[model samples]
Target: MVAVFSEDHVSLRASMKGLFAQHSSESEVRRLMATDEGYDPVLWRQLAAGQELQGLVVPEEFGGSGYTWVELGVVLEEMGRALFCGPYFSTVVLAATCLVESADESAQKEYLPRVASGEAIGSVAFVEASGRWDEAGVTMEAKKVAAGYELTGQKFYVLDGHVADFFVVAARTSGEISLFIVDRESAGVSAHLEETLDQTRKLATVTFHDAPARLLGAENSGWSILGRVLKLAGIALAAEQVGGAQASLDMAVDYAKTRIQFGQPIGAFQAIKHMLADVMLEVESARSAMQVGLAAASGHEGLDLDEISPLVQAYCSDVFELASHQNIQVHGGMGFTWEMAPHLYFKRAKSMALFLGNSDSHREQVAKALGV
Candidate 1:
């Protein structure tokens, strides 16, 4: 039975590999990044309708596939390998997970189906100019109004915010942090795209000028939900970083084997071989850490994610950033050139290391978990 399950896992990964190879080629990724929207809408629809990828983690009753975190990890790793540029992470991993974990059934019923169907692009706005990801980081205020609520403040580092149809915003209400849902096209809401270091991903600054919003969960109780959201997002991103590390290692090894230097293949040299070996070790080790963290987050009995999640985030970010740097070293000058793909992965590694929270912050979480 274990063998059978392993086979199933392999099959799922194969399917993802094929899907990305056909639709998310390197050229296609480059082309999509240059566009105004920074993603292929047709291919996005194909992924949603044909592959049913958008609803992979949503519960079956809520119009999703009812898949587990393990499956989402698989898809995320493949997406990272191909550098699939889209709103999948913001929509599924962040916003959808928040709704599923929140205590608001009405909000779940209203938004889950649209997100499952890929009819709406959703993002979570939590970061401010300070760029912190914890509950105390939120400074935006949601004021009580006759219409319902009014939000006034600005949020930066909103993933895919310029294109998201709606946002799950973290705001302060009566000295307590809360969550609210606001439409992107509302009268006083404005989303401006930011120029990010990684062109493959998008970020925005969203300003709420008395923008009308609806409370999501019980007022002053959204911090716990946001906590879960951050944990899940970290797990998902760790999986992606593992995949990216593998890709960088593969790129370095492949180039070393083919690129002749000093009248022989550079891979034959001891330095190149050692560098590749170290990167391979980092990639495999990080993959194991990510898999263990994914399992813990997926509700493995007797395992506590509070202990594993931060470790996974910190370690994976470090290894991926290091692997990307080593890949550039292996490629030499060509790695730094814009035309080469190593630069893209390098920037992605650096950017993702800081996403949601930086490695140092997560390391602090680990320290707190250990009571050190």
Candidate 2:
């Protein structure tokens, strides 16, 4: 079941919608995507200082507003709706959440304040060449050194890695999985941008050759910590997917209503009507799943996040892809052109489905959780 929204939630949504409409329009998105940074630094600072969105979930003592996951979900949904090209997911959802979920309060205190104030950008590096999101995929070695620890391995498809100030990396120590915090400027560390299907969100191949690192949480407990973080990430991503799906549906419907064929609007046709109706149904269903997932993440009673997170991820992934594809179909030839917006959403949908584990993998998780 979807959670009911309060008046504050409504106000927040409206404020975010207005902000994105002005700052993250299609032209601005195109401009930012083509840049080396893939986002606007000025706007990022505004999000932190003016809106305090970067610290939405960070606690009060950490220079944050101490907001809950539900509030962050609201911001992410608006970002997805606008196709805002930024490191928000990498920083807030991945890196910040990793710090918050870790057992090390020192790490949180050291990092969360910078993250909240937007003084630094952070990302998580876990997946290797195998592109696996599970603990078994973490093959990077972290060896104890006189100074601290040294990490030696490569992490592929790290979000915003090229520009991240720091990273929360997963590595193996004495054959046990562990997490580490590695500075971007650490000796023997390098990040190379990789060509991706979605240029709006950048990915990089990060190499660590005996790079200095700080241990996060307890040894051999990285998987458990990461499990909790990934569940929240899945829920957050599902909310974003729901927003994107709704935007795609809206675009398709608008195009169908205006484009003329046979002396009538294309939307008047039975086939088009049915197609849009189906898209609407899928989008709404995805939204409901996302809301339920968010509720589960918020510790709502009787909601098991282990089951709901994967379910929401799988369902939202499929829905967003379908909606984006149908949007292109609705636009006909114009959608195929670079000047149009449908292709961008389509690419984002496809790329996001693969991130943090694809729909098929999530489905398997759901099956395992349900024992079905």
Candidate 3:
């Protein structure tokens, strides 16, 4: 069965939109981006206490809202529209999903409540220096120790790693890929912030030198768990890209309608009209692709997420890149300035395009899945 978009979802979207408009304004995003923590703690708490946003997909038994990915996609879309500078994507989408999918009840009971309440922040350390997001990319070694295990290796491009309280780290255990939970404050664990194209989202390089860790799921089964998490993360990210594309279109259209040129609004020009129209088409089509991902993620029958996830990711990434670029073109010189919002969206588009994997890589995955 296909997932239905209900009035509740509409109401939730409206609520989140208002919340972000107030708390995650352009100025607020700029301010938070420059901060070390990279997000407003007060707003983060409000999301958990008032909106229960952090627990949207967490099961009810673990103090979460127990909602499905469809609702979570709505929240993420609004966040993308506002360019929210927070660790929600890392803590909820990446870390929480890993734990939930691992099927380790002990791990869930121990850590999920804290995540659901926003009392603790978490992220995943998956990619290494090679910058590959696949099973072959995991080279961090986890050796058995008297206490449990000890990890020694480094991870790069870990989203929000500097601010995370703990990490769901992927490492090689006995020559097999496995998952481990390591506290940020653990001995021999260090994180350093890294410069990135998108300032709104922070990335970090984390090194684990004999850091004590606890096994998350069954040893040697991490790649399977991570595969499911990546699929869900791809769907969620597609929703975010759709929102950003729409925002870019809105920004361009608004500027065109007001910015006067040649004795009339620039929107009156055939060139500007055609450009905006093309952006609109792309945005609308990207929304459709995002919906397909959401449906597949929400357990809609007869949908193969492995196929849909890559397709959605590739299409949305391309559409968002085009929309943001066209938004800059519409504004002429101002769009290129650091003061304008177009550059912000453009940077985010470029960064997100490479986050999980690039468009070409996703397309290759789709082709491989098709056995072509």
Candidate 4:
């Protein structure tokens, strides 16, 4: 049996890495970046065909191995490092987490197994025009109709909205927030892809014009569910950011050791040494924070991360930001060019750091958690 750690993961990661490395050639990365869909279908099928990533978070009963979140983190880090262009994050982590956060047994039974089997794609449609990730930011209203509920409002910056078959939308009903499941093909539902700086990850403007929606939980009890969802998403995103940061750090280290300047490898120079050491520190620190966050989310019991969650996220974001710029700095002019993949990783880092919450926002949360 294939393991999920060091050797097994590395071996599995190698194959996927080769696939991405082949496609990340200057021309291919640039072309895919410019395209509206932002990913190649052949590569997508390859991910599904191997099911190389199927067992991480999914429970065994749902046709998955029920492995630890850290295993998923390993895959995420490698994928982010390669600037792997795909829906794995938005669909698997973001949407799948939302499904697990839902307390409704009927909903989970109806959806998660399909996700585990790779038969359905879902997205967390929570953010609005304000880009707020909380209940107060949800202004979309759901009114009860004989058919179910009529949803009327908009969700902006929804990740993978253009392709998600089902959307876990946040809406207000009778002065409270709730999770609603809406079919993308249903009448009154529409979405258009949004232009984003990181083309590998797609964003979309979603509109719900009297769209009929099914409630996933108690009516008007959305805030409680969303709070839990946010915590889970925070942990997942923190993991992804950790993954992205590790990539930059690795690239910087390898480049520093090989690139020659002043008749010697730059790795011998004090300045380059300092930068690589700093990158190492950031990667290790971020990894520790992410591990703790994931452990807490994995139900270690009585571990209150209300305060710790944002700190890890903010810390990892800082790590990504610093490591990204440094990756470019270390490469000098070559890094600035589109032909090198350094800029691609840097671009992706910048975009993901801002999502969920930026370093600044997480700092604010850290303070809030302290009751200051």
Question: What TM-score against the true fold does each predicted structure earn?
Answer: 0.97, 0.99, 0.98, 0.90
The alpha-carbon RMSD values of the candidates against the true structure, listed in the order shown, are 1.7, 0.8, 1.1, 3.4
For 125-221, candidate 3 gives per-residue lDDT tens digits of 9999899987888888899989999999999999999999999999988798999999999999999999998999999999999999999999999
lDDT of candidates 1 onward, in order = 0.89, 0.92, 0.93, 0.77
| Residue pairs of candidate 2 with colliding backbone atoms | none
Question: Residue 97: error of model 2 in Å?
Answer: 0.3
Q: Which ranges of candidate 1 are over 4 A from the true structure?
A: 1-5
User: In model 4, which regions exceed 4 Å deviation?
Assistant: 1-31, 52-55
> Can you write out model 1's per-residue Cα lDDT over 1-372, one digit (the tens) per residue?
011125767889999999998888889889988876888777777788888999999888888999889899999999998898999999999999989988689998899988888888899999998878887788888889999999989999999998999999999888888899999989899999899899899999999998999999899878888988898889899999998898889999899999998899999999889988988888888888898888887887766787888889999999999989999999998899989999889999999999978888998998998899
Model 1 scores what on Cα lDDT?
Answer: 0.89
Off-target runs (Cα >4 Å) in candidate 3 are 1-3
lDDT of 2 by residue, 241-328 (tens): 8889989999999999999999999999999999999999999888888888888888898999999999999999999999999999
lDDT of 4 by residue, 100-162 (tens): 666677887787777766666788788888887766788888899999898988898888898
Candidate 2, position 160, lDDT:
98
Scanning candidate 2 in windows of ten residues, the lowest lDDT window is: 1-10
- Reference-based TM-score, model 2: 0.99
